[model samples]
Target: MSRSCPSRDAGLFPSEAEIARRLSQTPQEWAAKAKVLERDGLPRVDPLMGGRFWPAVRAYFLARYGLAGAEALAPDGPENLDAL
Candidate 1:
């Protein structure tokens, strides 16, 4: 069955702190996961922009929680990655 989407603002990705908060994890904990994400092909860090890709974060969310869980974490709701 389809799940309810999250309520998120348009054009804004969830910050690292926000993702951590939703997962009930400390920033440090999330950072550790980010490290793994980087190793798996997500950018290590955007030196100029100062954050990882939002899609990477969304993928991580999906890996950890599945579609419904990922949607729950996304304030702006899950995106249609297929459209990208």
Candidate 2:
């Protein structure tokens, strides 16, 4: 068998507060997600992993909850990262 995807790994982490600021979410909400990630063994704050994580999270919410759900999380949408 052969694998074509890169191995999943993470990097140095930031505080939830820092992530909250970067993503523009309330610290309370960040803290809650952080807790869930911790409980579920999800990596939410690793700097390197975070780059991979946040985008995937954004796509998920956009697909599941729609842009309106991400309004607070990503007010700028594709413009957030200049994808637009």
Candidate 3:
């Protein structure tokens, strides 16, 4: 799950539970985006993250929560930006 940042603020990143919650909030939104992605016909799957489920799931998370309006959650080049 979540790992506390070593910084003074020691904020928490999304845990598996948090990620699940964020992902669960708006399945319709994710389905819509996934449709667009499917139309575009990109790889839509990243082998690095254990097959096809992760990309769509991660996309849903990013669209729903990993972004703040327009900026990414960790915009200084997120470690897993592409996944989301």
Q: What is the C-alpha lDDT of each candidate?
A: 0.58, 0.50, 0.44
Worst 10 residues of 2 by lDDT: 1-10
Residue-by-residue lDDT tens digits, candidate 2, 52-82: 3555444544564546354444465344555
- lDDT by residue (1-84, candidate 1, tens digit) is 222124431213455665556668887897787678677755455566444556666665567555634333436867789997
Model 2: clashing residue pairs? none
| lDDT by residue (tens digit), candidate 3, 15-50 | 333333455744456446556765654234444532
By TM-score, rank the candidates, best first.
1, 2, 3
Colliding pairs, model 1:
7-75, 8-75, 8-76
Per-candidate RMSD vs. true structure?
14.3, 13.7, 14.9
Clashing residue pairs, candidate 3?
Answer: none
Best by TM-score: 1
TM-score of each: 0.43, 0.33, 0.25
Stretches off by above 4 angstroms in model 2 are: 1-15, 37-52, 67-84
**RMSD to the native, candidate 2?**
13.7
